[model samples]
Target: ETRHLTPQERVARGKAARADVPRSSHAEFVPPPKRTDPVEIIERQSATRVPELVPIRYSRMSEAPFRFYRGAASIMAADLAETPRSGFRVQCCGDAHMLNFRLLASPERRLMFDLNDFDETLPGPWEWDVKRLSASLVIAGRANGFDDAERARIVSSTVRSYREAMIRFAGTGNLDVWYAKIDADLLESLLASRLHGTKRGQKNLTRAMAKARTRDSLQAFDKLTETVDGRPRIAADPPLLVPAGDLLPDVERSALERQFRGLVERYGRTLASDRRTLLADYRLADVARKVVGVGSVGTRCWIFLLLGRDDQDPLFLQAKEADVSVLAAHVGTSRYPNQGERVVSGQRLMQATSDIFLGWERVEGIDGKQRDFYVRQLRDWKGIAMPERMRPRDMQAFGQLCGVTLARAHARSGDRIAIAAYLGGGDSFDRALTTFAEAYADQNERDHQALIDAVRAGRLPAEELPAA
Candidate 1:
């Protein structure tokens, strides 16, 4: 077992890391001579996914450089593997792009901002998450037509926020750090001076929070289900949302229900006793295959509709496939053999709180292939930020919020004292990351163009859906 170091020793170790890999070394990003073709990476991932949906993933990514970045985590992971590291590893949200941070309701029904997507979660170098986030800010800023100087300011401020937050966590008590969270009130306070200063800004923020609260299981039931033969069933929206019955016309509905019920019971075993008991109250009413986010597109995802006390009391649980994290190739495979367990464990470790229903199970598909899946409530009070709508100042404030949030997540799993010590009370790390962000953003644009070119040349099939 590794012996725990004293606080002074930890600080010295951090300083020593700085000496071995100078902080400024992070600013560079020269694509290695034999760098793998980014398109090939996407194609390899597509091979394991539902083939029909792979084109949708390519289509979504081809929309813009920022959108492409969202779906290109594997590509960036390869690049990040080549970057300098501080030799510290944490349970990382391997794809820590800006959009992944959002508002989610805690078990208490209190809204809080946190990292939501854990499809790519794994233990890896802390710098990977930080650099991915920084680069995302630059890419999004460029999409918004921000000048170079403005983008640099945004990236620097954000990195500085992360550095400063780590310092705070380093001095805080372990219990306090564990319980720390950015609740709705705290979020308002943080953005009060900038994002909530004007009446319009305040109105927008208030409206969004109020809207998020209404987006629960009941709301999803109303929006995504319809009554058929006096029974509720998940509605179909082809190539995006296809009801199980429609997707498999040959299978009997009763047989499908039996299979899903068995899956649910098995999944419930992974939850706590109380939660398992709670889950037992509902009966599986319907199931649907749904296409989710950009990177997640093509992955096998299913939504289970459960009803209690008549169709009115509904619960939607999403069971998404969990493959090996992109970072696994560079870092190491998760100790948990099941990828779903890796995601669930990483989320529980990195977040102050996670969905109570969060659990994992292995399922044998219709093709007789077993796949690992992590399950969670389909819709709670979830709110996402649209980077395309953000102004320069708004993005800067949002970036700072994301930065502090990422630091807190890292603090929960990594050595806060060591990381804070490495950062010190200077802007060196922040400035270096800002430089790196711009360089990586340039590289991202080139990769984005490459995808578009591939699509045009018929090297990759891309199905363009109408804008939402």
Candidate 2:
């Protein structure tokens, strides 16, 4: 709609937005009176999760402050509701933390860096995503032994990258902005230049790209599946991955598979006709309950082994339960009928490319209650950077990369010119976020300690894992 606006006009609008919600106002974080209990928020989230897996979720969340931050997206969402923000809204990855970005394969087999989690995605204030991401960097930097000043500098640099990227995108053609992507080769080359001939950085980038290439469906099959009775089946790793047969009695196994086949058929209806035809060639081989990631642990996640023509040709699909987004109560309920469809819609709009098999369906659970889920390839050359182990310099580069990628994502669905203008060509927004991030990081540590105290009081059960 603002396509008719001149560049200067868009910039003026951004400045006006800043005046309405001053950049300095963003540096504040005060828990409102009658603020919701973080633990109670977690308990509410556990309602529909598998009862046995809930404790595991607690265990993972208790691993470290950073891990706790990962699982505390709902808590942050509630808090973000009370923060100051510009009236501007965009399709946001509501849990836009540093850990959520990953390198994954597009349909064309090329690797790309993008937002990899969308469980809490919804249209909300752009600052919420930036705050969450910046705060996470502060927490992570602290855990890695970085000083407060260093953490602040890193956060500031990241916000600056975001501001500059938005400005650059604003001046580009609409189609060019739409096509913008951080391809693997291009990103590695750019990082090398930024590193100024740092051997460690170049080596790490090369190794990561090589590692990503070896992480396709076939590689996952080798590691996660085994031959049983001359047939390929998912290997059971109790408490983490339990095959369907291990959980269900013999009588119910056939019924479960039948239900799954029907579910797959219904899911197919959501895809394009050609993709549906492609899926028709594959038949289900096995299914297993999979515990994945700190935030997603308790949620219902299943890995399916599908065979095409022969045992060698296999496709693994994951059906992850999609609940109401954490942002829903704060912003507004999604327009989509199914929560799963809401996740899929937001992901497609925000990502430059997506897995071809991505789709959604609604199914009745064993409890006879309906649940919504989105499906996607379980492994398509996916790789994640270990921020915890990254050196200070590498972390700064990584932070800058994440910030630029996030800006691109926001630009796809928002007024880039206005956002760029709001940020301006100055350090004001960056400095404000640095202050906010440091303050929030302190709050995060206190919240983490609260969970420890809860465990001591026997109010919560946690199986503490050895710290990384």
User: What TM value does model 1 have?
Assistant: 0.98
Q: How close is candidate 2 to the true structure, as a TM-score?
A: 0.97
Candidate 2, 109-148: lDDT as tens digits: 9989999999999999999999999999999899899987
User: Residue 458 of model 2: what lDDT?
Assistant: 81
RMSD of 1: 1.1
Model 2, position 345, has a per-residue lDDT of 95
- The residue ranges of model 1 lying beyond 4 angstroms of the native Cα positions read 1-3
TM-score of each: 0.98, 0.97
lDDT of 1 by residue, 1-468 (tens): 111788788888788889988899999899999999999999999999999999999999999998899999999999999999998878899999998898899999899999999999998999999999999999999989999998999999999999999999988888988999999999888887756586665666788788889989999998998999999889999989999999899999999999999999999999999999999999999999999988889999999999988879999999999999999999988899999999999999988899999999999999999999999999889998888887888888889999999999999888888888898999999999999999999999999999999999999999889643
lDDT of 2: 0.88
For candidate 2, give the lDDT of residue 302: 88
